[model samples]
Target: MKTTKRLDLAIQKLYTAFHNNTLNPECCKQCAVGNILDHTDAWKHLSDNHGSTTLNYIGMVNQKFGKTFNGYSPLELLHIEAQFLKACGYQLPLHHNNKKPKNPTDKEVLFLGLSAVVQFLCKLDNMPDVMDCNQLFQFQPQIKTSKALMLS
Candidate 1:
């Protein structure tokens, strides 16, 4: 999956976060979206420097990538977070106000998650855009069965 330069950087960071097990309330509270949106690019006008909100970014995504995310929204993200957190038996810490001062829209949260997801899946499968095929992880069992197989 392709993305604008800044979004790509953000997606790559999210990819790294996943591998490093760094997804947490702190990062989410911080610039989860801002991490990429704040970058500088002379040719690009979509950066946060332009006073664009998360909704603006989402609209840009829909514009750039077509309507693949037309039906996806922030409610979907809240529910996804709730269900996944519940299944994992982890609970988000309680705060008087959980949202950050620059609270991102639900759609923005979903977009952030999705960008991470796409980069993650691409990394896992060695998709041409994000990872080298040789770097793909080789499961232990699969390694035992395949010749010249070892940890990626």
Candidate 2:
């Protein structure tokens, strides 16, 4: 089980990486999925070792888009915002007057959420300390029970 302190630190690092534009947009998605996968000892080794997971995640994403991951340069994190919005069942409003600002894409919204989560995690120490691993596991059986659940 991951400690809140550790999770908080990871979130802070993630946010810093994003804000500094140091994160590869494609890699960010892979990392997010990989972090969830890391909850299981079976897959934990994949974290910090980008070879297999990066290939796999990119392959999956490419398959979804009917494109090849190979030879495709990673996009800017902001550019993929539309993809996230579509995944979340949002439709960008049509510009009738051609003067309204465009709605944020799904990918942008997702990046924002990821950034916010990281920021929120960084602030956790200031919040009331509540649950230890044992208590959290007890309350959230899904986290403790299986890798699949954690990834899902």
Candidate 3:
């Protein structure tokens, strides 16, 4: 399947971050969108809160001007972060008292987060999810199954 340059780069960076133990849901510079933007925290300025999808004044202005960071609009970045955090077991808005993963760097946790982010990225580009394996289960058998054989 074909993929946009930006999406491919984002996926690569995210995979690297996850493997390097640099992916963190609580850290702006290490979050999903942050990693996609090359580990920059500048995207944080686009939103008032860590896990919020609402754009602040600066974010709104940038969106109005049709600006993009690594091929993602300000709103898209926010949504990506929110989705990552949620999949990593973080509560929205990311309050100190809110629920979060016991170990944010756990491979299992980060994998889930990355999976969600990758799926969202695919959705943005109108592509089938890269993390989806349901198709693998849809393979047709070379020989048809007989009802009688099944009963036996």
Best by TM-score: 3
Kindly indicate the candidate among 2 and 3 with the higher lDDT: 3
Candidate lDDT values, in order: 0.37, 0.36, 0.91
Across 32-107, the per-residue lDDT of candidate 2 in tens digits comes to: 3223222222222222332222324544454457541122222212122223223323333212332221433235
Residue-level lDDT of model 1, residues 1-152, one tens digit each, is 44454435545764554455444422332223323223212212222322222334644654466442212233222333333222222333323343332433344443455454454434433454443334355323343544445543
Least accurate 10 contiguous residues by lDDT in model 2: 68-77
* Residue 60 error, candidate 2, Å: 19
On lDDT, the candidate that comes out on top is 3
Q: What TM-score, computed on C-alpha atoms, does each candidate reach?
A: 0.26, 0.27, 0.89
Give the Å shift of residue 72 in candidate 2: 30
Q: Which residue pairs does candidate 1 place in steric collision?
A: 74-106
Number of clashes in every candidate structure?
Answer: 1, 9, 0
Off by over 4 Å in 3: 136-152
Give one digit per residue, the lDDT tens place, for model 3 in 1-152. 88989889999999899889888888889999889998899999998899999999999999999999999999999999999999999998999999999998899999999999999999999988888876557654455469856887
